[model samples]
Target: MLRLCAASVRLRLGLGLHPSRVSWQRQLGTHGRKESREPLNSPKRAKEFIYRLQAGERSCLLQELQNFESIAIAQETVEPSPPTAAQIKYVLFHNTLPFIGFGFLDNAIMISAGTQIELSIGITLGISTMAAAALGNLVSDLAGLGLAGYVEALASRLGMQVPELTPKQVDMWQTRLSAHTGKAIGVVIGCILGMFPLFFISDDEDKKAKTDKAKPC
Candidate 1:
């Protein structure tokens, strides 16, 4: 009988009730009393008691608290993020490289010598070779522009004020523009080459026919 009573008490405690029925009933009756005993202090009402030694309003303290809360809210609401290096490279390459390659290939044959070799090559070979050349030009252009942007970003992060350059200064180092010019020249050449046969031999092999026509038909 005593063991049974102990087990019941253990189960009640495990279930978060009082360990015995008498203790449980007492707790249930006293729940309201705990709420009524809470201190009756309101921060808004404290302003009415300003004449009291420790009850004066501290504007500086209130202002600091407001500033702290505003900062916390701003931090929570504004996400900290920036573009990755891969994204920047991707944007630069996709936006500028293809047109540059095509333009270069269009004009390639006019400038370079290896006409016989280029003629022996198929369109795929021609395109791939020209594309490679275009990519190289693009690399130089990007290197210049990228270096400038990188320096600017680094300076900004270091909290330094970088100086602005003049139009001449900016244009002098315009790598992308230089690259595009080369590409356009190449494409114009390539278009010419691709449009016409690589070489044209005159029909001078008909010299005997020409001589025979001079005699009698």
Candidate 2:
């Protein structure tokens, strides 16, 4: 009781001495974060947020595309020529998402590669390989729905479905599984867009080296 009273007294004294120090929650006179105001079940609010996110993505993609000229190429003395084995491999893996998850990826590639990651970037339409992958995101996701059918077929073939009261449960599980599978398709597409600039630097260096060697001494 005394502790409570003392805490209350201290709080009052602090408020009196520094009125500007009022807690942020109290100042706002609200108990919820800004986002909390939007009820998740409200389709209008949800659609608004999604639209805003898409608009922002489009804006960013436009900005990046506009800055292409700002990209400067520099060359230095280096080993391995243009289209060297490493460059080929890097571009291959970077463009193909670690060779469709079969090829070994270095730390950087692994860290940066992912279809969902690339699709989220949504800024590679200017590049051929990336453009194909980005544009294919929806088609791939739709095709992924086949995985759910495969699961159902496999379960029926194997008689894995429980005999108990589970038709609804199984249906629910299948829906979720199919949704996840569909999303994976987009990730695969995104991986196609991720690329490496390492080879570009080496190729530039190789070109410069050849030119310098050919110059009159």
Candidate 3:
């Protein structure tokens, strides 16, 4: 009996059970084995009980961990709210300004270069005004490719900033539509303004140039 109690105490200590709980568990074991007609000092039964307790502890810990993981996944999957009016305005501004500069430069360069090309080479090559314009557009496009970075940099320097938005909010159709609309309006305005070069070329000069091109040398 003394050996059994000592073994029980040692087993509980090894398993890191509190000393107070150990005494209670020891009493329960003693009474349990008496009722079950089992040997009080049976090492096999003691080991099996300890193993059952460890398994219960492991299962409880695993359940808690799974609950925590489920909560985290739920939070991540929740959809973000839509952007506010201020956010939409900011997005429009950020997209519009750079495109305005792009459109202005593109149209201005094309008109200037096309006029010069038509006067210089169109008559010699018998290239139509449309063909000259096309070539000028190509030059404008090439210049745009290089100037794109500068335009964006200038917009940023002028205090254009990206609005604070979640990934879902940024991807929303409303936000995307606002951005496209802003860009369209800006480019249209820029192109209209860029027609300033046409004012420099008189209608009489155009008519005279056409007449000269038609005359035989």
Candidate 4:
């Protein structure tokens, strides 16, 4: 009998019930209350009592857990907030600045090297200016492949940082749009600046004049 009582107390404690509050009499009353009170054997009261007990136990357990600093209840997932304008601008700046260097170097090298190639081997090989330019573009592209790392490193040294953003923010339409726009603007500006070599390049007519003057009359 003592062992049985101890087992009953253990069971009540495990189920988060007070030993003083839970009893065989209460259990029997709960089981037969519907029949005695309603005369129809309705299960509604018994189910309500069981549900209320379960809810109380759950609440008690949650409260106990909340008291401990180490234990935290996992909350429902929250939707990420939309990125702000400043964040978009920051993304644009970093993306744009690196590409500006890339575009400037690419176009400047292409123009300078193409002009030299045209004046040298292009004449002997009878290659058109367009063909010479294409060869120069190939050299530029190769150089770019090697210089890409340097450009990125320079940008980082200049304080370009990766934006602090959630995956959802990074993948948003606004962010993507701003990134592409920055690239386009940067490249355009850089390419335009790279055209400075044109000022030093003489026209085809001037070349012909110099060639004609060199020949005997």
Summed backbone clashes in each candidate are: 20, 2, 0, 0
If ranked by lDDT, best first, what sequence of candidates would result?
Answer: 3, 4, 1, 2
The candidate, 3 or 4, that scores higher on TM-score is 3
Best by lDDT: 3
40-133: candidate 1 lDDT, tens digit per residue:
1566434332222121123333443475567666656555343344433332333233333332333333223233322333222533435544
Question: Is candidate 1 or 4 superior in TM-score?
Answer: 4
Model 4, C-alpha of 181: deviation from truth (Å): 1.0
User: Best-fitting candidate, measured by TM-score?
Assistant: 3
- Kindly give the stretch of ten consecutive residues in candidate 2 with the minimal lDDT sum: 13-22
- Which residue ranges in model 2 land beyond 4 Å of their true spot? 1-53, 72-81, 98-217
> What value of lDDT does candidate 1 attain over all alpha carbons?
0.33
Residue-level lDDT tens digits of model 2 in 90-126: 3233223212221111111432332333334332322
Question: What TM-score does model 2 achieve against the real structure?
Answer: 0.20
Candidate 4 segments whose C-alpha is farther than 4 A from its true place: 1-76, 204-206, 209-217
Expressed as tens digits, the lDDT of each residue in 74-156 for candidate 4 is 21154667789999888787567766776677778889888888777776676788998988877776676566546654665
Better of 1 and 4 by lDDT: 4
- Segments of candidate 1 deviating more than 4 angstroms: 1-80, 109-217
Candidate 4: lDDT over CA atoms?
A: 0.58
lDDT of each: 0.33, 0.32, 0.61, 0.58
